[model samples]
Target: MGIKAALSKPFAAYVHQRNQAWMQQPAQTQQKVFTSLIQKGASTAFGRDHKFKNIQNHADFTQAVPVRDYEGLKPYFERVKKGERDILWPGKPIYFAKTSGTTSGTKYIPISADSISNHINGARDALLAYVYQTGNSTFLDGKLIFLSGSPELDEVSGIKTGRLSGIANHHVPGYLRRNQLPSYQINCLDDWEEKLDAIIGETLHQPMTLISGIPPWVQMYFDRITAKTGKKIKDVFPDFNLFVYGGVNFEPYRAKLFESIGKPIDSIELFPASEGFFAYQNEQDDPGLLLLLNAGIFYEFIPVSEYYNENPRRLRIEEVEVGVNYALVISNNAGLWAYSIGDTVKFTSTRPYKVVVSGRIKHFISAFGEHVIGEEVEKAMHQTMQKFPEVEVVEFTVAPYVSPSAGQSYHEWLVAFAQPPQDLPAFRLELDQQLRQLNVYYDDLITGNILSPLKLTPLPSDAFQKYMKTQGKLGGQNKVPRLSNDRAIADALVKFKVES
Candidate 1:
């Protein structure tokens, strides 16, 4: 083995040891750690400036500080935008990670040195868990490919400000950073076209082991790579062992990814956001386990049912019950206090604090997993529609449909079109292909003949927008509900008979 490979194994072992210790800690100890961190973070950021001299528990924290979304943080960001120092955190932040919200134009999320350190450490912990689970530390030896967001710093007000993805690339450990493929396949940095060319040029004969990125973007890269090289991905990265992806669901794209790379389900899904790296798939086979980062932030769980209720009970990490779905609330050092992340999850076990992502409380379809959510479904649709140029979707909604005859259930899609495809039947075929490629569950469901075929209905031009308007939820802060569990919403959509 080479020097770097030899060094990485021992480092991997060290990480595994640290991860084990943290995971083995009792729930009470974890809560204590979380509590101590929150008090420290609150004192450090808002203690002197804001009036929070009376707050105590997690409930007190949430009540003292109203739940703020990305837009709520804008005033603090304005100071940073003006090049002021120590606007949110104690020190001048090194850079900003630009991300988008459903309504907010673009969020320039600050990344302090401490925040960066937290992310790197969390990533290391995740990597070590992978090593322990897989029994393959050599997976770290090969060149790692990140199907990352555009790395180009956007030119704002004649000043170059790094986008979130680019800033993340910059902050990666220097050792691993050196082994990264050239800026080409890196996706969307400033010079996108040139970067694509560089990625194509460099990975011509390299031994890549790990591939990481959002699912849709990764598939896009694979398509581009296939077109350029005239070889399937398997031929290019024969030794690739692990695929680490975040910012979306891997279920939809699982089949396509594995088929393209000719690998098993050796993939890891990370639950990270522009705000912080929340959780990661500790075991490749398991969906993902929430490893509460007690050091960086304090976490709270509000029962999913309480989202609409005014008096929702907030549970600390220690108080959360297994098998129950809850919305995650976080208070991180970045100055977001008791912020609702909008995603929902359920605890599978409380000992090691393992959890499964139930769904986004704000984003859900039917009870079945068929209700695709943000990153996963978008990637699937993009992949499926790539074959058809004439078809363009302005908006879409998915709902559960149970066949009247056989009582078989499946997901039915309602798409509002910008333009209709010439061949509707062919479009359906393409959509099926895309869904199969995006998620193995759907593929397996189809192959097993357990679920009925996905049904697609085309809607009128202004149907989605009009519906949102009728609900008094048009434009800013309101998004077209992508997935809905409520049968009432589906019934309303069909009852209107609003075109396709």
Candidate 2:
């Protein structure tokens, strides 16, 4: 047996050991994790102020801490940044993940030493879970290239700061580091185009077997590699069979990415955010990602329909039912207490806790009370694209366009299509119809003449890419918000068209 193949046996065993079904005892397990977090962080100011002293169980903890977003937690985080020790987590955090802010340039999210293990190592554990369940680990023998951001570090709040992917890339164990491509020096260059070129130059001839990255950048890499070699990706790397993706939904990019691949390959969908590696595709048969219950993250759910209520129903694992869209709330070892990360998900399985991300709380347009979200928009795009097989949407975003002229408001959709639709009006009509069916509020708005029919504006090629670059979010793990409240991106799309 080959060295890597021989190692798979034990690795598979370890994955099996870690992922045993504790579904029946989910509440019991979640309560245990919650108790541990409260006790560990009690001495910290956040915990003490929230009266963590009197908290003993779920009800107590819920009443004590309350759910919070990044803004709600910002003041405390700023204190941590100013070299405060044991302020949020015990002692100071080892690093801070720089994530896009709603109101600022960036939000330096604390990354505890334990968070490194919880999400970073949990990512590996998730892969292992796939390997164990599928009994396929031969790819470990060859190269496993990850299109990652630079591990380039900065100091914020006296904490080391960079993208979460960069932080995790730095923590890749010595053993696997040998098989990873693109030297640390090359990745640190900061220019994505330059970094990708360096990666291609270094890895073009390697026996690559597994490729992992966000869908858009990964598609870019595949195209570049194919063009440079004048060969299909499968031909260039015959052993390459696994394509692991996260950060954005793969549905929109699936056809393009698969066309680049030139053959069928095993793929795994993961739900890894800056907050945690919450879930991943474990069984091939199951479409939903299996929630990582034991991975040092305690979870709660609140229905989106009741999000604005004075007191919404906060549900534990035992309380969730299949097919309900719920905003995920998490308490983690990263010193986060009942934090809401703005993402919404729907339960597909309640027993072992499997879910598909539904949308973002902030990334929705509810103007005119239509209540449209990313999932609905994407699904609409999917159905519309089906009618025109030649059309391929590269990237798109929707926003409300309110004019100074009364009764002229409508939702404006800015789309950069790789292959334009045969008839633009037909495409727009199909999308409008699909969205109306998906959202009753949207349907009512259309029927009641509260909003005009959706406006479709075609953008020049690479418009989204250029825009993201200007935002300093050009590459890894960053995605364009599918829906926006204002016309900033739509206006920019107009400027791009004029410039082009």
Candidate 3:
């Protein structure tokens, strides 16, 4: 075996051992770690003499604290915006991470020392697992390229941070950080054009082994790389071994990406958000296993079936059954007790706790009462795209648009295809039919005459990227809003008239 291959085996074994050790810990041990943090947070947020002792010990902790969306946290975030410390937590947080909220525009999320530790440790564990699964430690040791957001911190006052991705990039171990990359590649600290230019320049001739980021930004990076170098990504980074992506569904964009890079699907799906790095796909072969961050937070799963019921049933991590969909609720050190992050997931197994993201609870279009979710749209699109063997979908979004008349709505699909379909109408019908059959709610909406017929728009070749640019959201953490229910969605659709 080559020297690289020889090094890989033991590295893989070490990673597997560490994962097994984590998995073998008793439930009580994990719970205590979470409980201790909650106690500390409670004392810090409320007074030390507060009535609530711990998250699990207090019913008021659950009942009094209403499930909050980002908007609800605006007041606390405003404190960060004013450069105030100890607003969300007791001490001065290490930094703030600016993340985009659905309706509240942008938010400055606090990232404490402890939260940064969680992110680093989570990333380490994920990397260890990747080494074990791929049996390739060379990639781990080689230049790791992160197509992250700008590292620019705010020039004016307030908590002064750039994007969340940039903040996290700053926290990565300095020893492991690459040198050839642009000094300003840090998203939380630089201007957009300079940052993009730096990223392109640094990556031009580098032997990148790992690439990580959201799909859209990565796509933009590769597109620019190709434009600048007059070469495809594979030619530029032939040594690239792993593609790590998170923050949005990557299924639609995967085909085009692989084609562009001429690489196999050795990609890792990282389930991270501003809240925390929730989970990562352990083995590339299996569906992602929820490597519960028991050290950071207490977890509870509410059955997906209970979402609409009078009283929803929630289960502790130990109580969750295999093969059932559940919404996640977390009690974390950040002073969030029994907090529902509004994402849905389904357990594939119990022993190791493997799960698939079912959908986002709030990111669906149910305006006319159809209740279409991210997962449903993903499945329908996947199935429909499978029928057209030659075509590849690069980006797609669905919005519920109302007709000029009041109380009339329909599903409008905006799709950007890498290769145009030979039979566009048939493709649209197939997709619509798949959705209608997948969810009875959709059928009920249509049959009850509450919604107009499904509409499809084939966007211009550069539609999505242009849209992103127009919004000042061209890179890093911004994802194409997969589903939108806002009135502005209809207005945005006007920019791209129905394909001729």
Candidates 1 and 2, the one with greater lDDT: 2
Model 1, which residues run further than 4 Å from truth? 26-45, 48-50, 79-88, 154-161, 184-194, 364-500
The per-model lDDT (C-alpha) reads: 0.65, 0.84, 0.70
For all predicted structures, in order, the TM-scores are: 0.72, 0.96, 0.88
lDDT of 1 by residue, 1-500 (tens): 66666676677778767666666765655567556545555444344445455666655666667666667767767776776655465655666766555568767776666667667676666777777667676666778877555566765433346655566676677778766765533455334345545676777678888777765446656757877877778887888777777754445455555656655747777776667777877876666475655546667788976766877887777788887778888766665666787888788777678776656766865344553554455655677666765565656667777665453777777776656678877787777678777667777777777677677777764576567657644322134556766555566666444443
Q: Which stretches of candidate 3 lie over 4 Å from their true place?
A: 1-15, 47-50, 54-65, 73-88, 155-160, 185-194, 228-230, 304-311, 404-409
Question: Whole-model lDDT, candidate 1?
Answer: 0.65
Native-referenced Cα lDDT, model 2: 0.84
Worst 10 residues of 1 by lDDT: 472-481
Of candidates 3 and 1, the better by TM-score: 3
lDDT of 3 at 266: 81
Q: Estimate the TM-score for candidate 3.
A: 0.88
Tell me the tens digit of each residue's lDDT in model 2 across 115-153.
778767667876777778777888878888888888888
TM-score of candidate 2 versus the correct structure, residues matched by position: 0.96
